[model samples]
Target: MYSYDVKVLPKNTSLWGGVGIEKAISSNSLLICRNDELGVSLKLFTKNQDDGAVPFGTLAPGETYIFRLNEVTLIGAKTTDDVSDSMVRCTIVCPQSN
Candidate 1:
């Protein structure tokens, strides 16, 4: 098991910019949580950025989301507010390597 904090920047109105988690090379599960101290909402995406479409989901402050996958996958995140930065905690769980 491993965990880290990811910083998410504000996105422009015309461009969808976000951060991606690609470190879980062999992980089977992923957990993400928005920082309770932040006031901005966190948006989550699977695989790639949704460009101009709506995000896969949105997490309020102190809220959490989970993803189950059979292989490595990219997780994307950004803030709903266009002027403030936000953060999320990511935890990855992988099977034991023999």
Candidate 2:
């Protein structure tokens, strides 16, 4: 009943690609899956493509981070910024399947 998340359909979102319906999820905490912080998979893109990169090992309060969709695939990453009702959303701009 709080927040929500959804599987980005078609797997890619470009200017002319496609889009997935924004689902609601209650959990917003991000996951860092490596030793180096910047080498993370989950990412939040702001203006100028600034990385809302998730920190490794720990989830900081008021900070943004992300969870990888898998080992190789970084697209359709799970975002933690969508945790609260007031926090901003982190959407992944994937390539088109076709």
Candidate 3:
């Protein structure tokens, strides 16, 4: 298990201004949630942060989402407001290998 406080900054002209998490192990699932006390909406990207495609999903403050981690190579996060930075909390859990 691992926990991360991902910082998401405002998007700029050249970059999306976010953080990415690459798969490190054969994880069975992922638990992602926005900080309940503060911050704005968060947009999630399945591909690289620089990808031109739209975000796969969005999570509002105090919201939580769960899914398989193996299907994603990278997970990117960015603030939707584009004015302030957001701190998103992510928790990853992997089953022990046999």
Among all candidates shown, the one with the greatest TM-score: 3
> In model 3, which runs have C-alpha deviations exceeding 4 angstroms?
12-27, 48-54, 96-98
**TM-scores across all candidates?**
0.63, 0.20, 0.66
Off by over 4 Å in 1: 12-27, 48-54, 95-98
| Prediction RMSDs, each to the true structure | 5.7, 15.6, 5.2
- Candidate 3: residue pairs that collide: none
lDDT-best of 1 and 3:
3
lDDT agreement of model 1 with the native: 0.57
Ranked by TM-score, top first: 3, 1, 2
- Ranked by lDDT, the better of candidates 2 and 3 is 3
Instruction: Please write out the lDDT profile of model 3 over residues 1-98, one tens digit for every residue.
Output: 77777777765211222234333335476655555458777777654433443466777777877655554545566678758777777776656669
Candidate 1, TM-score vs. the true structure?
0.63
Model 3, residue 40: displacement in angstroms? Answer: 0.3
Clashes within 3 Å, all models in order: 0, 7, 0
